[model samples]
Target: MVAEADVSGKEAAALIFTYGTLKRNFSNHPLLQDLILNGDASFIGTYRTVQNYPLVCGPYRVPFLLNIPGSGQSVHGELYSVSTDGLSRMDELEGTSRGHYERLPIKVVPSGEEMEAKITCAEAYYAHGSYAMEMWKKNGKQGLKCYTENETIGYVKRKDRPQHLTFLDHIRLFLSD
Candidate 1:
């Protein structure tokens, strides 16, 4: 369910999971730049879809995520908190009105942390209905297979090593101080 506004007239922040161009430093990053900077956000988790989905290259070589499942690979992505207005702008850019994509809730778990709190539910833009089918047809099953299997494409593989310094690193620095 979409997050509802609070009694105080402020909308609850919506958590959105992104695995493609919407990611930081990507082509579409600017669309969410302000929201990400102004809101409470973090790289909360990484997860592969329980089912396989198509990640095909569209016109201009931009990748699109199709709704197909059971392809047997884990997809990785990040989650961010957004205001209702930010979500609406994202919907417009994603062509939600034209049915290019649909926002659907999904489950994800943190890659390295063993804590139960790391598992979360957030909304994501999945290629919807005929949009997915048409993209798959245009790209062909073989093409989709190759892209999903051989290429990282839209996935962000979790690194075994943490991207940020750990407590140990900070402690060591403190000792040297």
Candidate 2:
């Protein structure tokens, strides 16, 4: 569900669990440059990140939440008090209209709070299953590791061909952060 605006930034901040192309310097994340410039945003390093492909799993599906159950290791990202307009744009970019993904309620680590705060979370459409395990076996540790480390995303080098298709090629390259 979309969170009510009654919750202020100090009370809560929206959390987006980005395990794939949403990381900075990757795609249209530049549009969110205001967050970095305004000083209202900060990188919170305390959420789990995971990588998944919709084409392989199924069309228009959010990747299953992995790494931690409710909360876990910090998935590298920044949190900001985006304007309602900015958020509306994000919702559209995230394909919130599609049944595959939705903005559910979640807790974000406030800038200087002891506990997580209430916020909206974009979550996957399916039950948490063993897709990560399958990916690990399919790509081995190196490919899986590369995907997770936020290094050389979008493209995966082929071990045999030395040149090959990558995640970017197979999927719709994310157009927004």
Candidate 3:
């Protein structure tokens, strides 16, 4: 007798967790502009914000979160559910794989109600010595707090200054790999 084959359905939309610049008023945030001018994507409501920066996972050779909140107090952010093709566009927008940052799997929401989402992780490829180390290091154990206690959403104050690492530097490191 012949047996039937099992099939799986396609994934429904890609979810992204934004923390630093991707939120509302980060210095580099241009998503809203993209929506108005570029028309690249839209927002969803299925992600959680944690007080942590991206760290490299030795096993996957990728970056992942070191700390995240499990309850109370909402960390400010927006959940973007984009089309499959839009992920490529988002990658370009986020500079993923090009060394500025990368994408990785992360859980969203403190309640664990929704499924996991993709987050922009800082690349270890930037670890080109002490200079790069300095730029990529995270001081706060519970993810560096980018906002003060009284700061409102979309207006959080960054505890540190933004770096101006050029595309040339990123290209050099990534190409060397």
Listed per candidate, the RMSD to the true structure in angstroms reads: 15.3, 9.4, 10.9
Q: Regarding TM-score, does 1 or 2 come out ahead?
A: 1
Top-down lDDT ranking: 1, 3, 2
For model 3, the local distance difference test gives: 0.39
lDDT (0 to 1) per candidate: 0.58, 0.36, 0.39
Tell me how far candidate 2 lies from the true structure as C-alpha RMSD in angstroms.
Answer: 9.4
**lDDT of each residue in 1-177, candidate 2, tens digit only:** 333222235222343444443445544355455543543233334342232232122112222223223322333333334445555555655545643245543443433334444332433222123243333233232222112333443343223322464333323322111
Number of clashing pairs per prediction, in order: 6, 4, 3
lDDT of 2 at 162: 26
lDDT of 2 at 54: 23
In terms of lDDT, the poorest run of 10 residues in model 1 is 142-151
Would you give me the overall lDDT of model 2?
0.36
> Runs in model 1 with CA error above 4 Å?
2-13, 40-47, 112-118, 142-177
lDDT of 3 at 1: 9
Clash pairs detected, candidate 1: 48-74, 48-75, 51-70, 52-69, 52-70, 52-71
RMSD in angstroms, candidate 1? 15.3
Identify the candidate with maximal lDDT: 1
